[model samples]
Target chain A: MRRLAPAVGPLLLGLALAAACHPAVAGLLGDGGANRPLSLTRLSDLALNHLTLAASGFAFVACLGLGLGLVVTRSRFAALRGGIDTLAAFAQAVPPVVVVALALPILGFGGPPTLLALAAYGIMPALRGTVGALESVSPEAREAARAVGLTPGQVLRQVELPLAASGLIETLRTAFVLAVAVTAVGALAGASTLGTPIVAGLQNQNVVAMFQGTAAAAALAFLGDALLLAAGGLARREAA
Target chain B: MRRRIILGLAGAAVVPTLLVLLPLMHFAPNRLLTGTAIDAPSILGAMLWPLGALAAIGPGLLAGSRGRLAAAIAALACLGAFALLLAGLGHGAAAWTAGQPPAARARLAAGAWIGASLLAAAVPLGARRVDPAAGGPIGALALAASVQGLWLAGRLDALSVVVEFRARRDELAAALLDHLALALGALALAALVTGALALWRRGRGLVDLTVSGLQVVPAVALLGGLVTAASALLSAAPALRTYGLSALGTVPALVGIAAYLLLPLWRGLQGALRAPDAASLDAARALGLTPRQILTGLRLPLGASVLLGGVRVAAVQALGLATLGALVGAGGLGTLVFDGMAQFAPDLILLGALPVIALSLAAERALSGLEAAARRHWPS
Candidate 1:
């Protein structure tokens, strides 16, 4: 790694500097053509839409997933696991196009259906994470709790839930990132987000707007993930 | 317990097939002089074979574990009987429309389509995954041959999907092939990258994170990114345009689809190898196995199912994403969808969506079957 970096590092730096200094960089980074390039106002508007949409959708996913996960991990719900796994996997496999298209007719094309689709899409990974992490908790841990004076409910609440919390947070990070990115599809269904320019550009064959939209959306996702990682680190540090 | 599950599944299949077919006009006239759909006298007979198939399962259930042959036969009989009934319905339609005008042909109503799909789904659900009833090559071949034979006999020609297919036979055929090609091209590209990344000993985390991050990018933005990058590349290399590789169409579509595959494929490989655990790997090292020997001898072969699981996901995803390739003029089943959306024709949308769904399901089932077979016979 050390030897290769000496030869490659400066080359990459020079390329980045060269590209940043290119003639098209400004227009490429801007929202669209010179007539209506992205202003500070529009960028903030899109970033707000992107973040809020993801957060709202993520909230629904967290609740639905956590509730369902806790329910199905119960001993009585053992038989339900296979069906839930299949259903969630199926939900995930379904292309967002179908979801948006189908939802448009019933939900009548707006943020609701987009939110519906994102929440639906986001719930599966969270569910799988919660269930998997909970199940991976050893039987000995459960027995030790039982050997203590704790009731079954108390044991699950204090021990299993805390143990599973780390993995669930990671899953939510994934779900949030996914919701933010997938909201781009919602733009096609008439919901305004960072994807507005991307889908519109695709539809109208405008490459400049597309580049800008793509960059903005990617940046939003990057920032969302970074925020999640920082939050996770802070939580871990506080616990430590 | 096995018998009870098998019987329960069989009973479940019977209900839908019966409910959808019975008491309805197999082909009701659109000219319902009244409010309700009034059926012709002969339409009531469509329930006979389905009932017969249901009855066959009764006897099969009693035969127990020894009745593997009986269960297989019952499942086949149900599906075959359902297919024959559908064919017979087609024959009736052809006869009914024999003297009609050239433009006048009877189409299976939506009910018939629903019924047929239920029967198709039921056939698979009826088959238990036990020995002999696991649906072997012979059963698959028979099913394929029968489906083809029905097509040859024009038995399936009366369906609305067939009508739409006939209207654009050449285009639909080309689109189907194009869809397959696009999927394969994307998979090949992804597999190449995944294979390289798997072999690399360093920066695995960085690669995994980047790939996963790429996955979270929306399909639209990714496509846009691809287009932007392609345009930039095309502008930089004017000579490449002379070779028939344009900025749009297959090139960008393949790259876009490939971007989605890298994450799953890489994760699958990493997970599969990691399954052996560090302790086993260390033991292998102690035994003096070279790294190449370890990877080829242990990881790749033992982890075959894990790898295929990723490929299966990739393949199924590619099948659906290939539909989006049509938006860029790559011409796949997605053309049917976008065109249908453009024209606001629901049937045209179904025309596209149904086949894509079928292809995705088929790819998934086939991959799963391959994984099961590999796991059964794979080297330890």
Candidate 2:
């Protein structure tokens, strides 16, 4: 109960804020549009789809980024570090929308292209985080673990990863937040995320649907951030 | 004597060589339909020598202090090859459409784009891996010279993007200017706001809350919120419209971009202001320097690089977010991108996107160089 206490604040704050905003339906807002009024069932369905896309994108990025970060940091592979940095810098320079647009031709309109773009855009943050977190592990800890006659793999698992857990969690938080935000841009590529209505509104000049979509997207992003914060809090407490 | 190969050079060259095996161009009968892939070998027949040369030199570059000159030469060779490859791609694009009507299109496919971007980016990395000091300036000069050469000869004119650009030349120029104005204008505003907040000192909590709160909002949503608020205000006070304040254009776009920029700018400002060592600050105090003198004479000088570091981040981010401005009719390069998307013309989209990517990368490189120069002067 003590460990879980810190998680409750953000979780409750997120929920309370979300609930407060829930009543500002399209009809109440009164900006005229032909689009359907945003109902609770429809809203939740959109939210779930958004979450699914973001989660899958995050998962793919985490695996590839973590693996690449690990491999490049190894002694024998140190020569590849400069190349990885250059590639990562290039990746960062290209905007997420551009990635989505470019992927549209190859992957066609829908979830797959959005997913690919999200994965591409998210890779840089995850890779940078893993590399930075692992590097932050004190050299002394590794040396001490080695002195205890532990194998290289054992030292990494028992010493380095344990020490780097907090930073890694922080990295995941950043990556997840990014995934959530970029997924909204996925609507441009025909993925039925929250940005769907915003794009639709823009096309039809439907101010109300755009406003509602914007509010819902913002709420969804905040909710994800809060959920991640709670999860980070729980992890820290467990580590302690 | 034992010879060790430079792995960076080897990897950089080999990857592009492998990518060449994939489709290098896409040929479509018209702008709106699916295209067929064209292989590199079919287009670049004799011109593939540059690529072959790069592959041959890849593993041959030596690793060691003695290999510095070799690395520099190799770097120049790699870039020169890259320039030639680009020219080949353009010419190939032209030839592939020679027999077809003007409505037919030939654009660089995924493989060529991926390979070209990778090679262009990797050459510097490979150079630095071997000889960090000798390669940067000379390589940059060579790249500039080659690009100028291509432009002078009009070799890249036949490429689909250049064709698109010729059609919308004036619009493209105006969009580029708008992009710069939006990004830089917002950057300046964020700096001022951050500077004011930093001076307030008591607003630390306010700054933290604002920064984190702003981050939670998706950028498009933020823009939408601003648009709604502005329009509502305009409706309530019709007189404000006389002052040229309206929703749906530069006003909301600037505010939204600046709103997102506050976090990075504020963090940078705080970090730079606090950069002076405690002992240095104490010494300045003991020497009877005023707070203003200490800040100007000590802190500002030392923290210049750190502040510039923050500006680089904010600038890159601003350039990217500016793309969303097109959604609100704030016309920029994204106009071309969204227009192309609506028409399903990949080449047209690339025409907008490629420039944006180039601008951000150029900004990052220039700012980083400034940061390094600042560090050298400050010695921190």
Candidate 3:
């Protein structure tokens, strides 16, 4: 049972994705919206939006999180650090869906708000991880930099940041994967991301569109997570 | 040092100044009682926020640790003053429109929004070096000040969101209740599953990996899968339909929420038990405590805080995820948000979004309090 349960989830996910592509299966399940099956092009376009939003949003968030993390970790903003941490985690705890929902009014319909939501979600973990990583840096390294006549800024840039790179990279990897997953739900707000099929399918009772969308998204999420995990591992190895 | 100070001043002034100088508020004749007025900063309105921000910084830089308390006081005062001023402006706007329909209200112009956002930014900027723990209270204060400023001072009451909320008060109330129900229900379900999983300690590593893996699953896809699986089950059994089980309703939504929440609770439980205060357990055993006694009195009591922390995380998570249940027609606050969106009502979206925020934050606070209380009572 122990060996079996781990494999079961992915296997089920894969099977669902595969079944979504089958015309007869989609029909049998009453694939609701116009009873139409998603084409390869449609799936790919959705994936394209999904990837674009996730990549760009993740980049913006990671950078922002890093900066924010740096500021809060500083002696100047010391008092604000715990608040920042709680707020960030609180932001994360508030699901991407709610952010996207609130943002739509200000950002209007489409991919922008989705990207913003992804960024909001991404910032929390990135900030938390960056702080953790920077704090984990040995005091010896910090003292050594100070002894070498390095300014605080210089020490952060030259000594501490590079050493913290692996942990920071891992954080970004998590953020990137999470951003991609969150993007799929952006469809409800009118972004043609992979969630397009799923949201549409759910709305119109089209099981086929729903399954195809879910399958493609699940497959995409798994692929993105695996790639990130690999890249993070490799980066950590090199940094070490 | 001079250059650094100069750069800091520029960084602070740039955004708020542009917000003031530019068209901050856009008013339409129909949207408001009077003709469209953009950036109506009667001499004081324009100076108020910037001056308030400046006043906050001056005291902080002048005083040291002693000044921080004064600065904290100053920060709260600035936020309060700004909120009151903003509220007054909103009231004026509403009064002017009194002759016109109540729905005919002024929309937020660029200045009003950017100014407010800039003001919010200044709240943190006003803080002096103090205990980091104060961040929580300060955060609460800032949030209250800004939201109250926006709602009462800014006349968010006049917005379409409030209008929709007012119109559908019953439904909105129901949605809030529904939202709460789904969140608590899912957390309960997750607790049950995690309890079951706790028996199989050796399988924990795999469980953790699988749970984290699921965390990365796109929410839409997860919902889709649950919907499909439920439909498939109903089709196969036909008897399950009698139990309020369906592909598109509360059951599937509950399942989705439960699955999402399980990860946090299970991990929290596992981590709590893994170490179990070895010395305490040894002492308990030496004291001739029965296995059951240790399990109940020692293991459970010691693990309460850690486990509750997990529950707190899960509770917030469930609260958030429960919003998605609206997509599946499960009737939560998301339904109001989607409904508002479809009708082009921003106010309605807030009607839904605000409650979710309030509930999530409230749950976070409540659970954190419980966790703290449990720890206090437990033998350290």
Question: In order, what DockQ does each candidate have?
Answer: 0.30, 0.57, 0.52
lDDT of 1 by residue, B311-359 (tens): 8889988987887888677878888777766654444566677777778
Candidate 1 vs candidate 3, DockQ winner? 3
Off by over 4 Å in 1: A1-35, A38-64, A102-124, A149-152, A203-205, A223-240, B1-123, B129-158, B198-200, B376-380
lDDT per model vs. reference:
0.67, 0.78, 0.71
Model 3 chain B poorest 10 in a row by lDDT:
B58-67
Model 3 lDDT at residue B257: 91
Residue B241 Cα positional deviation in candidate 2, in Å, after optimal superposition: 1.5
Best candidate per lDDT, number? 2
Candidate 2 chain A, run of 10 with poorest lDDT: A17-26
Candidate 2, residues B226-319, lDDT tens digits: the string is 8878987998999999999988899999999999889888877788889998999999999999999998999889999999988998999999
Q: Which stretches of candidate 2 lie over 4 Å from their true place?
A: A21-27, A31-36, A203-208, B1-13, B16-20, B59-66, B129-134
TM-score of 3: 0.81
CA error at residue A168 for candidate 2, angstroms: 1.4
Q: Candidate 3 regions off by >4 Å?
A: A1-35, A74-83, A138-166, B1-37, B42-68, B101-103, B109-161, B275-305, B369-380
Best by DockQ: 2
Best-fitting candidate, scored by TM-score: 2
Q: Residue by residue across A6-113, what tens digits does model 2's lDDT show?
A: 546556656665564453645566635464556677767777898899889988988888888887767766766766776777788788898888888788898998
DockQ order of candidates, best first?
2, 3, 1
